[model samples]
Target chain A: MGDISTEQLAEECLAIVTENAGKKKIKAGDLQKAMAAKYGDQVDRKDVKAAIKELIDSGKCVYGYFGGSSIELPHVEGSAND
Target chain B: MADDLKIPLLEELEKGPWPSFVSDIKSVADRKPMAADLLRQLEKSYEDKRGYWKHGGLVGVMGYGGGVIGRYSALPEDFPGVSHFHTVRVNQPSGWFYTTDALREIVDIWDEHGSGLFNMHGSTGDMVLLGTRTEELEPTFRALTEKGWDLGGSGSDMRTPSCCVGPARCQNACYDTMDMTYQLTQNYQDELHRPMFNYKFKMKMSGCPNDCTAAIARSDMAVIGIWKDDIKVNQEEFAKYLDDGFNVQEFVVEKCPTRCITVEGKEINIDNSNCVKCMHCINRMPKALAVGDDKGFAINIGAKAPIVEGALFGSVIVPFMKIEDGDYEELYDFIDRMWEFWDEHGTARERIGEFIERVSLATFLEGIEMEPSPKMVKAPRDNPYIFYEEYFAEEDEGEGEGEE
Candidate 1:
């Protein structure tokens, strides 16, 4: 679970975001910590942060303001998804 | 400003004893066609007792979650000028200080791109660019960012942090409020631009306890300047104040919050241990008193307006945290600890203060791993009655008796 490349982590992040698209609100910190717990210290928070950014920049995940700012599929209309 | 426009309601609004926003809006209405539409729509609202603006869906710059507040005119066919009037929130400079050139650069762009109406500031401290069309967001954003400007926070994101005029112009300043505000803005760009909290979190910094910026009431996290040592005293200046007929006993001495001051003949002695640092004495006698050399900030938490709970003033968290130049790890780490807890525990739309209230302050303190301090509470509960609980208990006891 540890020592994965940023691209790998980003893929995993996308999987988590995609899985939670309409099920629950996925925040950056929630995904970051979930990754940190799954992967060991070899996977630093910096990697998860970078991976999230990578996912966002690549248009795989878009931030939508669902009660809180959340990562969701581009067009999922969560509450006030602005 | 519109020569032939008939607006009886707006004209009546301009008739009051005070300066009117109606007049101000008209003063600049000629600059943009939208202002006339805005006035006409406002008049219709006054007549019909209903608003004509509705929030639009999902409008913002690419790759950013927050910042753009989307507004759409409900009467789009009637007011096409305001059909897509979205507000752009530009992060104001630290301490809201701006040079003439910088101010000119912003207004000049707005003059070309969107509505000429700009709020010098919003409550959250953004220079609110009031009205703009959907097509112009990127251009206006690009124009501003090209001049090294950034957007402020909106939605559930950490709204932009604001600070009082600190060491720049104030004598009572105990910390570099501007530096703290700017560094937090830069360091937490993700938090400010992205939504991670259950609700909006605000951070406000004030140079001293006079609370010129109202951080205690307005922000979720408040960093206020304070001192640890005795307030510096100028005996010569103190004597001069009395000799000049200033009423020390009637004002300063009697008004000391803790009654820590004692004036005997010409000598003034303050009980430094009990000094609450409320600044009353210092304010009354500025030349004769100065704040101590040992300065730091007091971090308070959980302040907001009435939402999901009653309003709350910030409560003390870290009584004293020394902020060194170019270093902010301690402060950010502590804030994030509380934020993480709130993110996990708070309900949707619940502010941190409301969370603290629901879970009890002790639980919140434990969750954040901070030692509970005596200073955290404003005062002990002098009225600790459990009215509703007792009433419920009595009703439970009378459950078999039948409904009264």
Candidate 2:
């Protein structure tokens, strides 16, 4: 609710992705929507995009398109069991 | 193998005055197995009265998702030259304009990398480098890209946007169609390279709707230049035409699609609102009339071949729109919204036309927030009296249900 730093925004984004890691890759739009739902437009789309860019560039996360326009992380090969 | 040759029947094709394709095939048949097999296949097709090959496969380049198409021979062993035959697309220059040096450079690249065979331009407006081996693709693309050339789209993406020569060479052009096309291509590079759509998306433009590009039938998004105001009529020219044995009533008034034009003695009158601006009269009598002051484009949508639905010509969506400030944000936004709707709801391989059919036109229009207008109707309705809602309402009231 308060003025959040880019680091905090990135961590929150990473939390969303990590929480739903096996279900689906994190969509930046969806993450922005979640942020807006919680923070009520206090967090801008630019902020969310910057957070995702940082997450990808930080090498802490892998960015890939599984399908569609929403950039989803590739499902880690050995991480999932059929 | 020459004993089983069908050269005489093939030669029979060359007996005509015009040059035959079989002659070209035969000239290279001795050295190229592909050419020989092509001739043999033609002869066999003539003999058997059927095609010899089927098509399917996913052959393309790495990293990129489009701009290459896979082709293979059903009988690979017999026609080995065309076995791994794949078509490479080099993004053509605007209006297909190129200097002599540029052409030679392209041909030189193709000679070194491909089978030295090429199609000047494919239907999608790419300089098609035909019959290239799969192994030669990366280097070929590298060489082409080094020459300031890149690939056009091929599979499941926004295939290259092309336009007619606007303002550059033609007098009828209302806007800078070439620049618009170039801007769109430059801006949508990611869309061009990706396979994100349910199927391929095409965008094409025409200057003044003579439609030299044939965008209406071939493109998903067709931008055709249009005029909103009355046509400028040259009275002197009209009088001269009448004096020179040209019947104004026979040629201009009678041929008007809307019956909006009329001739009284020497004076010609037009009902501007009823005029569809089909350019028929203008074309027939170019010297007598000219386009109006207010000119823009009529954006049409959803033209495609039959896949899930029947083949459809593009329908007018926006009757006229001004492409101002060298910015097409409105068009881009509309396309984005439409893409979002299609991306979310469309089935795999279903084009936007089929999607519009699957979900009624009303729903599709609602999704894109476009209002239906009278101009939307491409032709007169069979029964102009019946509204869709009225008919549906009557049907819902069980008018025919119990009787049936």
Candidate 3:
């Protein structure tokens, strides 16, 4: 198993972002679809959720919990958050 | 002259050989009455030696808030022409070489929604459509966007990159600078259109060392073409130069700073060991000397006017990086890496160069996964010693040999 590349992660992240483009809130399922699209049948939903958590930790992605839905990838400061 | 009764001399002195912009403004003043009135105020202020315009304002055309820049005025009714004179900077095609139809479409659109007057190109290399009303901004932007056109930088954003005529017209080009410029522009439309950074960013590309675009002095990020191999000299071409009354001794051999060339009869032998690759000799003898086969590129940073820091000329960062197929994937990744690092640490209004200087180049390079070279010095400064210093100092000992 090779180390997870940022390019692969970014591609998955972009897909997730596009699906939830206009939505006020997103969910963990969005990340699963993103990961599925990239790794096909290999990526598990749990791993996808973990990647989102990593993005949040790196300050590259943000999230919010509202109305029982987790809105991942909120705007980061000093970046094109909007 | 009374306060309001004086004609401006600066306005009258517009007719001159020194490339006066006042004359250019006056040409449009007649067609547009409002423009004429604005010019009168401008001239009056010039005569009074006072600034006619204030800096900050909100001026935009209708529809989109992002598309139209909003510039308001303290006295809107008085200076009607300039009060809400919002300019729309349309991202121009790379190299600014547009087909007849593309140009016609843009002009037609501008004529319909905004003022007929155009600035041709703006400071950020965009087509500047001046004097549009705030109400028409969104509609105009939508119309342009529908036609596959887009707005360029105005405030703090990534500005459109510009390049000189490369393989399109010049034979000396090593890469398609124009195409690369367009690709970079298109790929980063979000950065170009949106205000994401602290201050405006500028990028420029040039075909070769001729520097036809003046990228070295003007842009914050400059991509210049270079060749890594030694100079190619044609003996036959050297003979032609000599036959044409060119002084081989005085002009060619003696003029070489490194004493790299030795002209013996028709044969001009070059010592590759001593050559500095300055391109001075190639410039002098174009036909005889050519650039090497192993072509590459160099990256430069921090070239801009004095603002937060003193003016800086670009210093070479990547001394000699291979430009494989001119695809520049590595270059693109490098840019992404730079943005990731800078965007994280940079404050509002901080340029990449300023950030690098503040944090130190070593740290910046480490973040970007690049190594620092000896060429990457602090900054360009004048060296006190000249070439003959050592020779002159040792002349008393009589240890050196004379010219053979």
Candidate 4:
């Protein structure tokens, strides 16, 4: 799989975020690390960041800088739990 | 004996060659007491070196968030007539077309409810009815809206979309610029009335690369009509042009950006693909040369007034895309994506051009799913061959190695 397209990375990112949901805000850095570990050298950091932006922009997830260093998904009002 | 009311510093404004705003106001000041007081307060401010007016807390009408900018002067107790002079923006008709009856009706309404004065058309293409009281805003809005007038945008929302007169009047028009502008304005009412972003957004359209609206410099996003094919040249017209004072070598041939036009004895040949379609030839020889058949728009991004930074013209993002059926879903999606990214990340008072400057053009292109093209590159790159991100992908691939 040639770097698992940005669309695919976005899906993987969402799944990772969902699993980490309700525990705490999913850290952007941690999410990048997890994707890197899973995909090896197929994906670059910029592509991962772009994927994360796509996820947030698409409303599949919400993003905000948590504690100023890392961006995390914020809770939405009407979304079903988990 | 008006010297008693005049401040000497203001008289200096009238001494210049050009017509003075001070003098114009003075003419109106005789009949309008508020205008007299406005001049008085302005003179006092120049003397005192202070602002005579102040902005109040957010004031708006029922079910609306924008289109009214509330202003109240601190000198209300002294100049009561000029106290609550708020600005109300009424959306203008497409291509600024207005019948005499419509014009008279608006003027009559303004005369009844507002200060009789109105800006024929504001810079944002709105009919700016200046100097009205807070109490009169709703009734004025009601009267106008009842007669099918709506408000233009203000605050942090999308400002009114403006366009040049297109196929209706001009021959150079490649697309229906007026209809495009009207369609965008009508479809995006929510974006106009609702102040949801960090700053204002504006869209402007021009029928052709002539850019009558100056959309590239004045708007946040511009859809300038363009053609992808060769320039249409008329041989018969070319001969007449040659008979006249038309110097094909001095004006048209030399001015061609790509040196695409060749003029031999009684014959002119153009390399169609090499032509940049800059309209230099078309403008120089109006009868001889014309625009091509295959037409569309070149979408651009990041134009704005100099606020947080210097004024910047929007750069070409997509060189050409056909705008069919007057449908602009692609353009709208591009706008939405851009707004989503900017609204989430932009700082207060930073225009899109300034924001793009902070974030490299590469990031914006990536975010918008647009691959960088030669048209999007404004200046010559240090390495002429290395174009877009793909060129550096191999170099980026070397990044995941562990430390030695």
- Give RMSD to native, each candidate: 9.8, 9.6, 11.4, 12.0
Worst 10-residue lDDT window, candidate 4 chain A: A63-72
DockQ of each: 0.27, 0.06, 0.04, 0.03
Which ranges of candidate 1 are over 4 A from the true structure?
Answer: A1-51, A75-82, B378-404
Question: Model 2 over residues B258-358: C-alpha lDDT tens digits?
Answer: 78898878878887757777787888788888777777777777888665567777777666667778878977887888887886677766788778878
Interface RMSD of 3: 16.1
Top of the candidates by lDDT: 1
For B3-91, candidate 3 gives per-residue lDDT tens digits of: 23233565567665676555655666655544554565666566677755443223332211123444433345666666555578888
TM-score of chain A of 4: 0.76
Q: Least accurate stretch of 10 residues (summed lDDT) in model 3 chain A?
A: A73-82
CA lDDT of B74 in candidate 3? Answer: 36
Q: What's the TM-score of each model vs. the native?
A: 0.86, 0.75, 0.71, 0.74
Write the residue-wise lDDT of candidate 1 on B1-404 in tens digits.
88755779878988869988788778877767788788888888998999988765466777676788878888888877788788889999889999999999999988788888888789989999888887788899899999999889987779999999999999999999999999999999988886666789999999988878888888999888888777899999999999999999999998876788999888899987677788889989999999888787787788888866788878877767777676889888998899888876887788988889899999999999986644565411211101122244355345321111
Candidate 1 chain B — worst ten consecutive residues by lDDT sum? Answer: B379-388
Question: Order the candidates by TM-score, highest first — what do you get?
Answer: 1, 2, 4, 3
Candidate 3: Cα lDDT at B323 = 56
B356: Cα error in model 4, Å? 2.3
Top candidate, metric DockQ: 1
Rank list by lDDT: 1, 4, 2, 3
Pairwise lDDT winner, candidates 1 and 4: 1
TM-score of 3: 0.71
- When just chain B is superposed on the true chain B, each candidate scores a TM-score of 0.91, 0.86, 0.82, 0.87
Give Cα distance to truth, residue B12, candidate 4, Å: 5.6
